[model samples]
Target: MIVQDQANDFPVGPEDTSASQATQDQLHKSYRMPDEQARDPALHIAKDWVQKKKLPDMSNITDPQLRRYATLYPKLRLTSDGTLFLEEGTGDDQRLRLCVPAALIAEVIRCLHQHPLAGHLGRYRTYLQAKRRFYWPNMHKHISCAVEGCTTCRQSKERKATKQVPLGQTSTKEHTRFAKFYCDLVGPWPNARGPGTKKYLLTLQDAVTKYPEAWAITDATAENIIRVLTNEFFPRYGVGMTIVSDQGRQFISTLFQHAVKRLGVFTVKTQAYEPKTNPVERLHRTLENVIRCSMENEKVHPTQWH
Candidate 1:
């Protein structure tokens, strides 16, 4: 059945409030409020509607396309002449539309001069860019970074980003005066550029001094590190009272621990898998900055950290 503004087609003239089958059906299904998935209350409503077969009211629905749903489900109900909304459930909260519809969100945005949560949205974007495997907005990948909901693309569409871990570790670099140290190994850098059978950089940092020391290696075997400490590092600095490094093979080797014990030096490694535990991580950042600064300032790549 088709409805029109003219009473001739709808059969209900200005005098009568009564409506034709087509007019009532169209009005009933025309309510096209967006389903908000991020809001728990909103998502709960959508979930209940979809799973339990509780459909929205279809009376006086103004949207022509959505009115089609009324034809599909006769059980759906509607009221308000298309203004307010009410539904029935055992509980007051369940029966009510706890969430504002997507249409309402746009309306709110339009009415308000500024949004209260707008400042926090940039941080959310950064988080989305960094991590790509997160199940943020439950919708299918509809937006870049986060397409879960239009919160970007609400309902039926979502783009997930990765999850970020909260390791929450930092170095004592800021507190001590050359007291804390961080050490790590970098590279089995490919030997294609220059024909070295093996190469690595054993990096060390002074927490307070912010000074970094690099020891290049052609071989990174555990024995090599023990030998380096005995030969190069130990002789100049003496054994540090508390040294921090990662759980790499060289650091964890029984030989390294024994050597430290024999030297009467205490050793502390970073929390397992937490890179920030070592102050030297900052030094690595500095080194990268230096490389970048040199490239920009000098217009030539500085030699790689040898």
Candidate 2:
């Protein structure tokens, strides 16, 4: 209200004095400032200038860090009893507000966001609650970041792929490193490549680490499937003790069954049409989302996932 407009070098004119003082009085009565800023050195200096007429010469205020607070001195005010306030917003909507220290911003954001009546509400609602009583630079950015990173909001509010079934009984069993894996097939996706115009993605996931590997294949033949397992996967990670896959033709074929047995790896097939019995099926949604977002962000062809 009756703030020193730091941008201006001169004192207030006589005509503006009464109205400005009245506005300041109204604000002081309507809202209370937080006590935290009273101990803040920057605010102490600001208050000295605004309320006690003790403005220190720039050179005398030796802390270079204080310059940031000094710059805001003109916009800060102190009530008759010495509570610090900041003049914010614009005319008709302009008001004095409690100043929040940098250290307390996160706590303030959490309190407002998780307030019983307002918990899990979106950004704008949380911001309004904060703006009503607190004033800070880049307050909106702070609020937005806090709300977006909220764990509850991420888990419950955000849209995600529907789960087909609970994590399978096999998934709950402890898996030894390089001993158990979940395998699945994804796509007849666009942008087919390689010999036979590859269109399918063969996905393998290590159950212990949850690490996944994928390869593009033109067909789901038992020969191609066995080749991926023996040549590509087995060589790098060593032969797993057990391999789990949906009961697709390629997985259940005589060629695949014999090939895995010869390699000393046991094969377990999921119940018919129950893809969730193989853990890798759950990862397909996440994998597709990753590829879709990457293509959108990088301006690449959708088939680039191949």
Candidate 3:
């Protein structure tokens, strides 16, 4: 009965078997191993010890390479086909990572990084992909060097210029509110028929509390700026000790300087082109965005922004 069953299982009368044979051949070609891990000199000692299930004592091992394998024996596992793997992680998260030899580390990294799926990613990302299936000493360092030396990446990627100057301290010893003020002018927007036909905005920001105030004016002249500070700002918040502003013509004018001096407030002009030194520049961006949104919501023309 057993012989009869085996004979029936086999193809006794072959009929149109060419397609089936081709499919079987294709499957065998696709499933074969890419390279021979047994031929790697670095993993030969570990493979032998793992196969025998007997690790020699590290104290008596004279060879440096053999001693290294002895140290890692607990984590090493040998496959039936002689390939070595490093057992990593714990419990449900555990993985068997192929132990790559030193000589093949660069080739493996190149394959992973330059592969169409990899898209030539950065060092850390490529290292993460490699970590999923390969194990080697100083793997991160090797991958980093490989990425840095890649001619394609060097030629294609844009290098960002780092800021040379460090940030300057902006905090004051006195925590008093309204102790310092950052002042700047925004626009000459489209002329609108508001109070004084307002087209420009004079903005002031408190250094301590960061409280901001703005006034619309017809022009950005020194006289107009001084008039606003004297009539409006000083009456409400009182005079600040220090006034920080950029080197605008109005801020640095002799008339503007005299006006602040009368109030016993020191005026500081920022460097020629460095607006970052003044905190009010940041306030301008936020204020402009708010104005833009409000205009859009109200269906107001640019000329009627005031």
lDDT of 3 at 13: 24
TM-score of 3: 0.43
By lDDT, the best candidate is: 3
lDDT values, one for every candidate: 0.46, 0.67, 0.70
Find the 10 residues in a row with the least total lDDT in model 1. 111-120
- Write model 3 residue lDDT over 167-223, tens digit each, in one string: 888556758788889999988775465666778899999888889899988988999
lDDT of 1 at 103: 32
Model 2: runs farther than 4 Å from truth?
1-172, 191-195
Better of 1 and 2 by TM-score: 2
For candidate 2, list the clashing residue pairs, or say none: none
Error of 2 at 123 (Å): 14
Give candidate 2's whole-model lDDT: 0.67
lDDT of 2 by residue, 115-175 (tens): 4334346688778766665666678999999988976666545365666987655435764
Q: On residues 1-306, what C-alpha lDDT tens digit does candidate 1 reach at each position?
A: 111223321122123221122222233355333223323343334334444555677675555433433343322222222111222234432221112334333333221111221211222442332122111221122223232223321321222575998988764436756565667877665431455443676787776776778777767777777777779887878765567888888888898889888997778877898887776775654444333333343344333534
